[model samples]
Target: MDVLPDRAARAEFPVGERQLIMKKLIINHDRLKEARDAFARFHFPVVGGVADSGSISLVMGDSRTGKTFGAKSYLGGFPQRPGERGMIYPALLVEMPASGGYRAILENLADAMSIAHTLRMNNSVLTNNILRGLEFHEVELLIFDEVQDVCDIKNPRLASDFKRLMRKILNLEKASIVCIGLPETYGLLSSDKQLVGRGGLQYAFLHPYSWDSDEERKSFRLLCDQFDEGMPFLNKSSLGATATAERLHWVSQGIIGLLKNFLFIAGSLAINDGSIHVDTTHLAQAYDWIKPPQTSFNPFRDDWSKKPDTVVTTAPLTTHDPFAKRKRSAHAQ
Candidate 1:
């Protein structure tokens, strides 16, 4: 049963990820393998790192830098060892709400898992059951993206409980956990020594590829080429050898996650207007579309001067108006 695209997508899932597919955007097979190998080694990022071991991790980056994308890729490839078959290993991925905590985290998982039983209010028992279900599913790994929520743990003890849940993974019949979020994730780890010390599970961090690097640009171009077939209309090819990956580098602030939304918006526009391909104009519009609203401006301030000059104040006078000539004709006659 494949999930097909439709308008109800908004009603069904969160934004950005409703129709997201890593294969649709990046050739991360090699990068993906590096993470898996690192996990096997117990290296800082791979094994001994906070990212790999902390049951809850905070993976933060500019909007689109592949933080979520990388987690999805890992989830897709989790527990790849042989004899891993007949394993009903369940892999559950859920977003941490903008403001989140251990309770929200548990509830989201419980709901996503669609467990038959009720999770007792703030009960750790159900949380453990959630962990046990993964074991029953033979799921070897657990990945929770949008981890910035770990910071939402206000119950001073909530953080400890979150860590405790992670430690339980070690107690599982067969399971591994990966928590990803923004830089705040590291802060969460620094506060808890015991949580950071567990077999020193590795923290795998995926950095944004430098679109300016000749090498990096080459890869991005290759991705452009790979996607050309699907994006038959987005003639990213025209930009070709000269395509300024740097522009994307600057705009996306070098986050692989950001590129997906930026490009998708551009591509969707081209599709709608029946454009032959994606061009600079399409890119510009996409830039606006993908930009999250600024946090600094206060609508209540009533300070017009504080608003960005770029904010539109009036529709530009248009030549295409059907009534423009009629007014002139009346005057001329």
Candidate 2:
């Protein structure tokens, strides 16, 4: 009995797309440079400002714009030049508890430094551990992720308390602290009034292509083209898949998160097929699976975006802060 026309069907076709996601590049390249430049500007000894004057940048953009990676990668670039020390000691990357206070945040910082946090629910010990970790690493900057999970701005009492503690411990005199979170996080940051008064280079806003110029679109596409698995290689994009590749930017909405996932899954499927080249059919499957190639993060509604608009009215994290931080939410989703 004749089986079928296609025989070696189950082979890897788009291996590159399936693995090397575009999101990683955004984090490692596009965003990293942003942080470095911002920090460099503020690192000035006499930038001249207020109590805490340095360039404490806030990258609040649409969700999936690679905010986490953008800020986190800043950790790896150290020694910001000789004699130019970073704020944090050894680099403490903390994730605030969804419903937590100073204690929970300190605990997370300790964990990031790989130090044993003997908090056992003890705030003092937790604080001491973090201090030691920071001192050990001579850390210059403290990075907190999912800061939005910590609170809402409407509550005056909570907001006041949060501000007091942050100033006393984190901001105290002059420590460059970087907060990583969705655009809403910036709202929470500004609600403190005092926090916002310090001044920050606000970004992290995903444009959603609302007013993108042609050059901007072309540049981003060019970057993605470098890694487009449907294409041939760096110099030659979509050598065989050129026709289908044209729509890639439109489908991915220039959002790294969307593009990465689209390529990864579809690329994997193609790779599994072991085809030497991808066809429009593969792009369709990828597009369908990707759902939103051009998805944007509407920070106001939820889940994720830009300069951070008006602060949302909610109480800041107090004694009642919970363990349900952003990671927990991410896990839940």
lDDT (C-alpha, whole model) for all candidates: 0.50, 0.48
Q: What is the TM-score of each candidate against the true structure?
A: 0.61, 0.64
lDDT of 1 by residue, 1-333 (tens): 133343333223332342253226454433444444533443134444432332333344433455565556555644333344333534556665554566776776666555445544545677777776665555545666655455445545666766776677655535556666665576676566665565443465655555545676676655444444334342333432433344554444444444555567766665556565666677667666544344233222324344343322111111123122111010010
* Model 2: lowest-lDDT 10 consecutive positions: 324-333
Model 1 TM-score, all chains together: 0.61
- Taking the tens digit of each residue's C-alpha lDDT, what string does model 2 give over 113-138? 66676535576666656555555555
| Candidate 1 local distance difference test against the native | 0.50
- List where candidate 1 sits over 4 angstroms from the true fold: 1-62, 77-87, 94-101, 111-114, 119-122, 152-155, 171-174, 234-236, 284-333
Q: Residue 290: error of model 2 in Å? A: 3.8
